[model samples]
Target: MSSTTLVIGGTGKTGRKVVQQLRALGEPVRIGSRRNSPPFDWENPATWPAALAGIDRLYVSFQPDLAVPGAAKAISDLTYLAVAGGVRKVVLLSGKGEQEAERCERIVADSGIPYTILRASWFSQNFSESFLMEPILSGTVALPKPEAPIPYVDTGDIAEVAVQSLLDDRHDGRIYELTGPRQLTFPEVVEEIAAATRRYIRYVPVPLEEYVEGLRNHDLPPDYVWLIGYLFGEVLGKPGNEDVSGDIERVLGRPARDFSDYVRETADSGIWNRVPSSS
Candidate 1:
């Protein structure tokens, strides 16, 4: 059996880290991305088999998100192909509180392949690397769900756990809920960033509908707007979503990175210090 591991979404947030860590451990890895040799695209099933060929292990991070429509069927089809191709183990990155993502989890679990699921809280990097970055750069983060206390886990921790799951069969069939050690509300997050960067950043809480309308007004894709709305409405502030989990410590023998730690490190990188351009 081939020992190669295929990391789907390998260029993405957690995927890239997983790839890096695996490579650091001297494990064979193939990046499954549209730009790779055997391109793996989520929307195109024809690209999958080639990427899965000769691969014994897999790391699944769905593009956009698994909450989107058709994600379950996509996971189902991918796992089916993997099983037929003799892929031995699979590790999936999933959203902590998303019901829709759970459906995709079931597909991978029942696929007759050994699997581990990492159900993660909202990422701390969302503020520095994702949609929230723009608002931070603009100095005013007008978002909904101001009061929702989120245990924003770092992608670094998530990646470490993922790498452990991929290489060690001990993690097989285990579902790990990954979260940071503390919860912070939107305003508190802003304050931490503000202090770390020594820049004035404001957090304005808006109505959910108003926030969605703002995204539409800015001409963001309809699907992206829909996802933002779904995440804020369905997942944020829901009970238990804010609770911190010790799974990271359990898996990696260390406490999960705190949001403040992320903020300080990212601040040192000067990502939050960039001057916003005036149009």
Candidate 2:
């Protein structure tokens, strides 16, 4: 029953939704992002203590990705500070296929706080707001994941679950693996977008090498390239991950939104209708 909720990565896809939901429920929400008040920068550990000062509960999301290097150690360090600062509850966002992400989850469980783990599938927003957005706006999306079937979870559902977990003590210690109700391959997902937007969207299968080179050609950092490569090449295609999960329904008592629904919704948002940002 913590009223003051701290959401890290609070400006990103799922975090933004979580913040909106918490505020809608009349909870006092604090955003923990590089630009948020009491700014929290993951690379700068000095800012961690200030962000945790008044927080009794936390929705912790690491930046870029949880699968990246040093994530576990960073989580471990942050959890120590949270515990020391009187944090009693935590909801950690985790990647479904990432062992590294799980390492961070374990650290939170060991932090002696009431905790919930939301092991999320690839996000539908990956195409609309994340790395895939640019490629889509350019009319061609290329990646290493051509045949890799994914159950892309909606950010809305992830936020709903996160808000519930932060507010409900009964949900503590639960590990929920949330996915969409159906699975889709990259090309198939692209086709769904094409159908939704009434436009042609092509999906190309590229080797990891070529994808990294593409990232470099855009003057992006290698860290971004490496993270993207790992997700597309390592996490996207797999048997255990391709199936849908009912955790979203079980937690929220409603069916998860489909990829087609997400595409249609985002298509109208004008996010896809305009030129994608180069940032």
Candidate 3:
């Protein structure tokens, strides 16, 4: 009998992929989103129990990020509920080299439930699907840590590993440091997209403070501004973050998707080629 799995951030970048893969495998899946029936919300603890009621396994992708303040407590609380609610296994999507996210990892580790932790370096989709998309579309990708070589793992890889962890007991009690096959600096990344899309995209290196200030000037949330700063300063600025990991290949028996591959695929999708709508 297939156990029903609850995907905490089911509608998010990796969560949606996890849900799709699990469903394609004929496994029962429940999306834990505010808009779903028996909604599961991070800020509303009351909604968690109903969502966890019949869930035997869980995929935890915390909203915003696990590095944010109070994230540890939330993970701890969720883990406690899950254990008591008969959840047999858990898979947490965690950020690599993030100190605060590590605190949350420890909570899940000691929860007494079988678990797997996927500490991912960065997502290659950021350029096409996230904050960096605006800059790319603007043709001027300005940011800090221009020289920080990042092995940006693909979300599809992360999702596959996550599904494997949830279904396969061999992954339990294991922590996988997931990364791309190679590293690329910010400018190199921009160049790859430019070459793939045939667009003139320029990369500008700025001070971390200036970048954060620009986010603030755009009227972004205070926490988001702080998180961007934290990620750039603490994660990217930290040495050795550029190092590649073979965990994805070890688990999947295939090489992790390279950034250039991601660029080519995304470029083919015509997302980068779309002209920015002047609203």
Candidate 2 residue lDDT tens string, 104-211: 888999889999999999899988776678888888888776877888899999999999898889899999999999989888988988887877889988897887
What are the models' TM-scores?
A: 0.97, 0.94, 0.98
Q: What lDDT score is found at residue 192 in candidate 1?
A: 92
lDDT over C-alpha atoms for residue 189 of model 1: 94
lDDT of 3: 0.92
Q: Which residue pairs of candidate 2 clash?
A: none
Q: Indicate whether candidate 1 or candidate 2 has the larger TM-score.
A: 1
Worst 10 residues of 3 by lDDT: 270-279
User: CA lDDT of 182 in candidate 1?
Assistant: 94
| lDDT (Cα, 0-100) at 228 in candidate 2 | 79
The local distance difference test score of each candidate is 0.92, 0.87, 0.92
lDDT of 1 by residue, 75-143 (tens): 989999999999999999999998889999999998989999999999999998887898899999999
Give lDDT tens digits, candidate 3, residues 1-279.
Answer: 669999999998899999999999999999999999999999999999999998999999997899999888889989999999989999999998887798899999999999999999889988877888888998999889887889999999999999999999999999999999998899999899999999999999999999899889989888888899899988995877778999999999999998888888899999998887653
Tell me the spans in candidate 1 whose CA falls farther than 4 Å from its real position.
277-279
Which residue pairs in candidate 1 collide? none
What would the TM-score be for candidate 1 when compared with the true structure? 0.97
